[model samples]
Target: MNIDEKRFTASTEIQKPVPTKRGKSTTTWFALYGFLFISLALFVYVTNVLLGPLRLLLFDPPLFLRINELAIWYSGIPLVIGTALISWDLFRNVTRIRDAKFVRNDPPANRFLTVALTAYNDERSIGGAVKDFRAHPLVKRVIVISNNSRDRTMEIAEQAGAIVFNETRQGYGACVHRALREALKFEDTELTLLCEGDLTFRAADIEKFLAYIPHADVVNGSRIVEQLQERDTQLSLYMHYGNLFAGKVLEMKHLGAVSLTDVGTTYKLCRNVTLRELMPLLDPRINLEFNAYFLDTALSAGVRIIECPVAFYPRVGTSKGGNVNNRIATRLGLRMLWGIFVDWKGFFHD
Candidate 1:
């Protein structure tokens, strides 16, 4: 071959692109749409099955045929169309769920604080919990309230070198009230996080909880259920069931998110000034053992409750609170249930 012909051949080889069989976009779309169509069909069936009975209940005219036809047959098409559109949007949103990740810093946004932890009989795991808080670069100071422990909880906590406070309060709620009462007296603290002695949080998550507080007076970390690996004993499940019930009630009342259930948590971050003022209003009779729905009761007094689902670890130590005959959790659950009405204010925030 001539040099020109060889050059042209080499150029042709270089310029040729590799063949790639694009997977059938047509088949994928068909499958997705087909699933949606089947879902719509199921939606139509279920809506008719459920609403048909309701028509009889409402239609006191005793008109069986008219109500039966009107209830299901008259509305089937719209129900199917509505379900398909909504399911499509919902499935689209499911794609974005995994986008969430742990964020240690809250950009230029979060108001940082010296996270204050209070402990009583936490000899087993206070160190790890405090270490978890101190691990975050945002943590400036950790004040541990080693209140009247029967064991070496104070020694382990003090050895941890946190500014430890030893108090003689008979109740966890009382200890917290006393601890915060003393802490607020100093006036040096900007923000104080009141974490449960046992609860575990992810790194830098306190910042996420704090980011919403200036906008919301009380910013609470909520579990969005993307990850809730913490399995608790009866105490934990009782708390879980209470929380689920409270969440539904709040939704019904249009009340914004409040951790009405898991209120024993060690992760309460509060404005020192605001908390000090509110502490006096708290029912001193309550303790962490059987009570603390006072946090929910605070909502009735117009305290803003913003939920931020902080990551949770199952209880390293659980108690016999939820045993078969222990009316304790039931009573507390009743308090939470009753408090929804007794201490509830119509939702003031979105």
Candidate 2:
């Protein structure tokens, strides 16, 4: 059954315009008088030439297509354009964005963090990663998962302040399945950042980024190509072009809240509720081909994602992800593309 809903204007009468800041008489007396001055000059010049008695002046300038004649040219055009632009700006109202309020779930407790390290075999650098995660102001817990590591990777992670979870019995997805459940056990976990254990980030900067997310579903840091100017980790030309293409493709899709492939992004912010809701999407044991495999899934379930521009420091340890230089990565990208087409219905369900 269709029900008719009647809606009325919410406010009373709209307000009238008060004199604006720009409405003040400007200091540019020249602009206001330029036209009048030119008109006066032309009038005097014409009068001197036409009046027989006035022609006796020493400067009875002959109007024989003189220098200033054709040169009177379109000089006033700039003044008109400038005035129009100023008037447009002066009349337009500057809008202010209201800040969103993110509700806190639990009473504030001492720094308790549940940093998720999704790793395959980051044994060489897992220790450093855990230390960095623990160094945060309130990180109380570190949940590390050996996605499919064969070495002493889990042990190194455990020693570095993380309670390592083994997923050898299940697929990488299933390991994340188990890891997230454990991370959520702490009642006072104010922030949870799901990160791969291979990359390095400034702990302070990461925290600053997280603080902005209380009102946002996801706060992403976009890569600034400028920062990489002095460094050699320049994004391959192909990757740069590919990323641009991907951005345009996203616009074409017009999925208002849809995220980019990088949205799984090296970093992600989670409100406890959003995290809790997302855990179930982990397919028990498939390596979850893409780390952001759950992004489209999350949006389908209704989550907001936003990108904030930032500079990324080049990788310090063994890099797990980078320019799509290899055939494997290329194939993986193709798969993602194909999935986008086939699952458009699910990805944009909202």
Candidate 3:
């Protein structure tokens, strides 16, 4: 087989499994969301119950207590365990930030980073996205993967000085996998910046990424900063908290030593060596939650990851990814967690 054929075969050999009949149940989805809502509410209520004494000391005591003593004993215990986990994460990040040993200088202008962006029906924004990255002094070339976009995305990207490629496979995971593969092929590329072909993220943040990339194999962007996010962005209040909650779960699972506040961001910088070593082990069939899967696999391979706070703007076009709606994001988040826990071995094997 030719190189292209071999690449195609490697990507498809571990394709995502076909869904069973039970997977089509709408009732089960409702139950899952219901369960999540109640669990979150109970945790919040119990945490508040634990703070009752301190709360009363700071504010006026309420005539009627809303929390029951039973919940304080039942849920509060689990809350304590959860708090311990978060505390440990906080301690680690605090030490890393405060210690001069962890401080890293930004990459010099000569340290060029190749940019790769994934596009799917983003004709309206791909050109601007490409141009933004190309304008960056540290960016050598901008590469865009138009994942079967029927629009003018390819034309616009090429017009904006990007090397455009078509990815026939139709998943966010597949598109990203293709982008990474193509990025590593460039001999000049030392680091690759991967992002979406939408205007949600800007090129100005590339400097921030370079500063953090020296300390980590992968520097991931975090949109959790309230001040940096534009109004009415794709990250709604529900989606924002949900993403953070999922990030916390992931941190607890594979990366307890590091505190990760955002695992869903597509904009990240990865060393060429890290991608060369990491991509072959990734299963593109993992679908919309590929970022989490990548992080899990990278951590397993001992890749250091750090988050950089980046500004988030409202997209010029509609979102086509899992963040299109809260329901879609929730489903994707569940799939991510399921993959992390139950289907751990499945990602490596078929």
TM-score of each: 0.57, 0.58, 0.73
Q: lDDT tens string, model 2, 1-350?
A: 22322222312223232222222322222322333344445655555345544444536567733534443434345546545543443333112101211232222233345677777677877788788878876667678888678777888888887888777654545656666677677677765666667654444456555555643555555453455223554354554555444443332232333335342245555666667877776454434343445554554455555555444554545554434255545544544444443442232211
Best by lDDT: 3
Indicate which candidate wins on TM-score: 3
Winner by TM-score between candidate 3 and candidate 1: 3
Give the root-mean-square deviation of each candidate in angstroms. 15.8, 19.1, 13.8
Candidates ranked, most accurate by TM-score first? 3, 2, 1
lDDT tens per residue, model 1, 1-350: 99999987765552322221222111122223333444456665676677666766876345754665565564556556645654554465443323321112222233556666666677777777777777777677667787787777777776776677777756666676666665665555556666656545554577677666654456655543445545643335545655565554443332222333344444666766557557767654455422234455445444545566677765544432333334676655555555444442221111
Give candidate 1's TM-score.
0.57
Instruction: Give the better candidate number (1 or 2) by TM-score.
Output: 2
Ranking by lDDT: 3, 1, 2
Clashes of each: 10, 4, 0
Q: Let me know the TM-score candidate 3 reaches against the reference structure.
A: 0.73
